[model samples]
Target: MKRLWLIAAICTGAVLLAFAQTQQGSPTPQTFLLRYKGKPGDVSRYKSWFVMRMVGTMPTPAGLREGKMEYQSEATYLHKIISVAEDGTLEIETVKESGKARMGDGERMRDLPDRPYKRVVKMTNRGKVIESREFEDGEEEQESEEEVAEFPIASRRYQPTYWLDKLYETAVHNIAFPEQAIKVGDSWQEKVSEQMTPNCKVPITINSRFKELVKLDGKLCAVIQSEIDAPIDGQDNVGEWTVAVKGRFNALMTIYFDPELGDEVQAIDEARLVLEITLSGPNRPTLTITHRLISRGKTAKLD
Candidate 1:
């Protein structure tokens, strides 16, 4: 009888736990009201002011490291080809960048590349990055693996698809799937999620919506960054990302630009956005991005 009672108690506890989880599932979607004054650059032109602070566990070739850092970046870009004619090539260029990042203990790092760090992308019309070469300045050979792993590093010499993904995800509503195109959103809210790989399968979730146009720096600019929820990469992201540790997260972020920059103001196009993503799961770990900053500098303009 005692053994049977123990079994019953375990089952009851499991039921209650499930119920609690269900209750927490319906989280009130966090919202941010960002009102700023900026110029409304043309959608075709590119101009941006980006800032990011991220803290999470990062895996390096040597092992894992923990730290926090922030970066401020600016850029001007031009879209050389929007809809290419048959046999025509598309091009993007970066004009300028003046940015720095603060590592743990406020150690300043400098010398980052600008926008359009030189990459060749092949994608269907639906806006899915099929394949491309990630930028890597030759400096990797000079530094030891441990030295290279230090945080708050910056370089803008090369283009990375991950940054491109951020830019495309924010603006492009539809993406090309293997067979057909998948619509990210049609109306009010849009949910964009991606599973980053190599170290572990850490999924990133970005929830955004169309906010009103606000004036910034005496120019009309579009403001975005409704909500963002991400799990710590590495071990913490183990066991399918759940609602508990991963869900108790929110962000207040904004994307601003002068309409004069137009489509050039796209997130990744304007500058390399390296945000310090935070993760508070079973183990407490902090990580930072120590990589290229920005290289190209081209003013945003219509093709």
Candidate 2:
């Protein structure tokens, strides 16, 4: 349960910078109302890959030396919006293309044969995630002891699908535009929630500014800078294990939105998180799995 919680928290931690102004000529003194614009059934494809590394000490027993473990994951995802609402909310669906995860690397890497995992997200134009549902075929993923042990950290079914987690994080943690338009240097704030548990919700603070206008892939894009912070601390009973976690999570993101197309054409983002954990249960002994997670990725629109 400790490891499971840590994985979930890491996804939340990505619960997603500051680029100081450069001598590049100031952006036109024009305010842009950045929002997604598309008619119902209008489709768009997004492809992105991110690498996450966890390095730190794991929890130790009462009299034992502090044990430590670290691992790396690399994954690619394919997503497309299938529908849109009049209010700007949209429904998205995606699946993992391929990748190595948890301790599954080197010659041990096993690509999911069927790629039977999928996720559907309903998100508001302001970038809030209204609902996210996951689907996977268990029979298609039956594996051996060695295979199951390698993916012990991320999910209940022992499937190393961190990309789905990344997709979930992207859907839930994102920009919420301000009501009014603004020019470069204009700043605003937003508040969202992270579901630590059914009854416990943690508020996440997001500060955004219209950093500048830049050109990418030959299209003019609004370069918005943002700072995301979440102080997550809590405990809960998850099945047979008793779990507790506390940590500070933060990220810096620079998004390039295509105003004319009303869609995000590209984005560069990174995040860091440090957490302390404690756990106890029948077979699962108390564990720490202290970790610092670093994530780097890029997302771009394809038509």
All-Cα superposition RMSD per candidate? 18.7, 8.4
Instruction: Write one digit per residue (lDDT tens) for candidate 2, span 97-215.
Output: 55454443233443433334567776665565677677665544554544433423333331113322332264234566666666789998877766643333456778889888888
- Give the distance in Å from residue 18's predicted Cα in candidate 1 to where it truly belongs: 48
lDDT of 2 at 17: 15
Query: Best candidate, lDDT-wise?
Result: 2
- Give Cα distance to truth, residue 188, candidate 1, Å: 5.2
Q: Candidate 1 has what TM-score?
A: 0.38
Error of 2 at 23 (Å): 26
Off by over 4 Å in 2: 1-28, 59-81, 95-114, 139-174, 197-201, 236-242, 280-287
TM-score of each: 0.38, 0.66
Displacement of the residue 63 alpha carbon in candidate 2, Å:
8.4
Tens-place lDDT per residue, model 1, 190-245, is 34544332243434444554354567555655544334444433322323221111
